[model samples]
Target chain A: MPTINVQMFEGRTLEQKRAFVKAITEAACTTLGSSPESVDVIITDVKKDNWATGGVLWTDKK
Target chain B: MPTINVQMFEGRTLEQKRAFVKAITEAACTTLGSSPESVDVIITDVKKDNWATGGVLWTDKK
Candidate 1:
């Protein structure tokens, strides 16, 4: 039930995404003690303008 | 890839989730014109205490 969603800055290659999914899935299995099959990792490449933190948009703040 | 993430109040059945995924997938395909296979929807059921909006936690604010 440990469905991990990683929202990160865009411009990553397909290979980089595959690596991140693999690593996060392994970490979930180890830390959360869940089966690899049960874990679903979804990567959402968000544009800087679409994300915000601490009440400031990433693009504007960055 | 218009991956949809629906974050709502938890305690829904598996059937409900399946329905949500199916509905959202179709919507993505229709609106975004993306392939169903390319659409990956991940549901993250966060605790009420874990989420915040307008600088106030959901649980505490609610």
Candidate 2:
């Protein structure tokens, strides 16, 4: 079983998440030889203020 | 660098999250030889409806 956690900005619709998870499941199955049903995708809706890159928060970026 | 994703039920306070991340970062430093700054701890607050075990959704469990 393979568990994947995706961190992205919030505001995605349920339909968008459904499609995203479907694509991830397929990719994991094809590349890792894992069963589609056995793959778990957990999406973390991160706020810009909470995520930092290169020592700078995304909210502070231009 | 080590990135740890923790999946737990929601409703934790800010202090709890702070302690959790601190503990995880320390553990990674001890076992994986990763620096505290390089160990990223991402906590995913999963809803019962979105989590499942043994083919049964957590929301549907007793």
Candidate 3:
């Protein structure tokens, strides 16, 4: 089983999540020769304060 | 960078999270010889309805 975890900024709608998982499953199957049932996509909605880049938190970024 | 992602049931306190990340970072450094600064730990709090195993959702399990 191939489990793909995505950590993104919070605020995506339910419809977006559904479409994202569907597209990701298809792409994984096409590229890796995996079955749709064997793929798992777990989405994590991260807050700006919880994420950082270049040693600076997203919340503090300009 | 070695980014460790942990998916677990929600409801942990902020103190618990701090302890967890510290411990995990130390473990990675000890086991993988990676620097503590280079280790990133991302924790995802999962809800029962969103996670499933063996074709069964956790919320629906008895």
Fill in the DockQ of model 3. 0.10
Candidate DockQ scores, in order = 0.04, 0.12, 0.10
What is the alpha-carbon lDDT of model 3 when measured against the actual structure? 0.79
Residues B1-62 of candidate 1 have per-residue lDDT tens digits of 77666766567889999998998899889988999999989887754443333223345543
lDDT of 2 by residue, A1-62 (tens): 78776778977766566667767777777888887668776667789999998999999999
**Top-lDDT candidate index:** 3
Error of 3 at B50 (Å): 5.4
| Candidate 1 chain B worst ten-residue window by lDDT | B48-57
| Model 1 stretches with alpha carbons more than 4 Å out | B1-62
Interface RMSD of each: 13.2, 4.6, 4.5
CA error at residue A59 for candidate 1, angstroms: 2.1
Instruction: Give the alpha carbon lDDT tens digit for every residue of A1-37 in model 1.
Output: 6756567798876556556666776777788787766
Chain A TM-score values, per prediction: 0.78, 0.86, 0.93
Computed on alpha carbons, the lDDT of every model, listed in order, comes to 0.69, 0.75, 0.79
Model with the higher lDDT, candidate 1 or 2 = 2
TM-score, each model?
Answer: 0.47, 0.55, 0.55
